[model samples]
Target: MPEQYLKKILTSRVYDVARETALVRAPSLSRRTGHTVWLKREDEQDVFSFKIRGAYNKMAQLDADTLARGVVAASAGNHAQGVAMAAQRLKCQATIFMPVTTPAIKVSAVRNRAARVRLVGDSFDETLAAAQVFCEKNAQ
Candidate 1:
């Protein structure tokens, strides 16, 4: 990629994901599983998770035309907040779909990211389907 594009990628919304998240070697877990087990301590993320990386990367890679149309995604957990925050930083409209069963805390976090939040179905699968339909209809 060109320097400009590389810069965009490096400084993309995903960049906001803290690199400080730990990579802890877990000998106990490794022994239990009978294999090497290194925990990617995403639990330490600013939002207390790692799903934000994909969310930011995906949104940041959008072409100018796609961004003009906005973006939508379905997620019940960490992913929802990631997408919301990334969209907010990119100054693009974002719509998030989550199951009605999602915890209030997660819902509040997504809202904090400034994305339009919709509590749709009873399960993640149903929520995802609804979000996909919505995205397709909106050409997102």
Candidate 2:
């Protein structure tokens, strides 16, 4: 598993969609703790989360045929937006399945990224199952 992660990190193409976030010192926190502290500004990303890096990297690694078959993910938060944005950038179709209880704003965000957003079950487990079924039926 460690070796697989190392290979993925070395081959990642995240920079195609994500910039290198800055690490800035936290002056107040450092002063209070009497130790140097730094903050990775992942929130500054286009998706406002580091999930974009992993999402883009995974898509980037896919072959042309796989990409053509499309991508699907189950998420309601930042991961949804990340996968949507990555699919748009790669010119691949993406289906994002979110729990029915997810807020409209999150769904809107994923849709804005040009992904097909589906409101599935009311919980994460249910949503995941729905996505899996979709993938199996679509051969994605």
Candidate 3:
């Protein structure tokens, strides 16, 4: 399993949607701690989060049939935006199920990424259940 993970990491297709973030020194933190500190700028990604990489990589590796059937995900935060953007990049139809309580800004962000957004239940679990049902009904 470790070898498989290593291979996946080595060959990940995240670059299609994510850039190689830099490690930059944190001057203030370093000074406070009396030691060197570096921060990984994952926020440099197009989605402004590291989630895009994994989302894109997973979509990139999907079988043609699966891609054709499209994808469904349940998220109300960065992951929703990540999946939406990844699906757009892959030219695959995507459905994002977000909790009804999600902020309007976040919902708009996910919608702007070109995925079909569904405002479902108020909790993550309920939202996830809605997504699962959608997947089953749509044969995703």
**Which candidate comes out best when scored by lDDT?**
2
Q: Write the per-residue lDDT of candidate 2 for residues 31-140, one digit (tens) a residue.
A: 99999999999999998999999999989999999999899999978999999999999999999999999999899999999999999898999999999999889888
Model 3 pairs in collision: none
lDDT of 1 by residue, 1-140 (tens): 69998887667656654556778899999999999999989887766788778877887788888877888888887988877877887888888899999999999998998888999999989999999999778776
What's model 3's TM-score? 0.89
Query: So what's the TM-score on candidate 2?
Result: 0.89
lDDT, model 2, position 41: 100
Better of 1 and 3 by lDDT: 3
TM-score of 1: 0.79
- Residues 12-70, candidate 3, lDDT per residue (tens digit)? 89866788899999999999999999999998887889999889888999998898888
- By lDDT: ranked, best first: 2, 3, 1
Off by over 4 Å in 1: 1-13, 31-36
